[model samples]
Target: MKPDIRGRQPANRRQKGAAAEEAAAQHLIQNGYRILDRNWRCRTGELDIVAEKDSVLVIVEVRSRSGSSNFGTPSESVDRRKMQQVRSTAEHYLHVKKQYGRPIRFDVIAVMLNAELTTASIEHIPNAF
Candidate 1:
């Protein structure tokens, strides 16, 4: 099996993550954010979603949880370490794309999927950190 960046992930988990990201992207679009990139990679890490609205560049982190919320909400999963990684990656992205001197914001999108993966609940938190 081909392993992902974090290591080998079960097919179902990967699929669910992909679905969640897609839903997040769609939600952003629906809310008038223009998507700049998805799954952007750098030496630091990957940016789940990069978008822009009213000339402000937005860095979005997407987290997904299935079934119960026993472990906690998906947004709570993005701790300091993960935020640092996202920030580092966003810096690399700005440098590489020459998007300097622009306003920036960090956002977290939590997606909760039902057990059958037929429906999802999305929560968007702007200026998350």
Candidate 2:
């Protein structure tokens, strides 16, 4: 297994990311967002979360990283290519679900986990795209 710059194993990083995504999902649920799907995927790409608030469908891209990592903030990691892939994946989801004419928006949930990976700081950006 490859070790990160800080000597942490790759599996540890994956575990941290998964934990962060779970926390982000729970945070959204507590904020009145109904989760429709998690890890929805298509030929284009994968969406981290699909949720709804009121009548609007929200596609959420979850970005997660350790607090002391060199990867920069989670939000900064979602670059233009990532946004494009997310947009394409959302289109595929809409077509497959036959969810036409419904209001849609892209969102981003940035999660920063503590050193122990138990606590998280979450930033929700609605209409991110």
Top lDDT model:
1
Candidate 1 Cα outliers beyond 4 Å, as residue runs: 1-11
Among residues 3 or more apart in sequence or in different chains, the pairs in candidate 1 whose N, CA or C atoms overlap within 3 Å are none
Write model 1 residue lDDT over 1-129, tens digit each, in one string: 566677854359888888899999999999999999999998999999999999999999999998899999999999999999999999999999999998999999999987555446999999999
Q: TM-scores of all models?
A: 0.90, 0.88
**Each candidate structure's count of clashing pairs:** 0, 0
Q: Per-residue error at 94 for model 2, in Å?
A: 0.2
Error of 1 at 58 (Å): 0.5
Per-residue CA lDDT of candidate 2, range 19-115, in tens?
8889989999999999999999889999889999999999999988876758798998999999999999999999999999999999999888876
> What's the true lDDT of residue 43 in model 2?
91
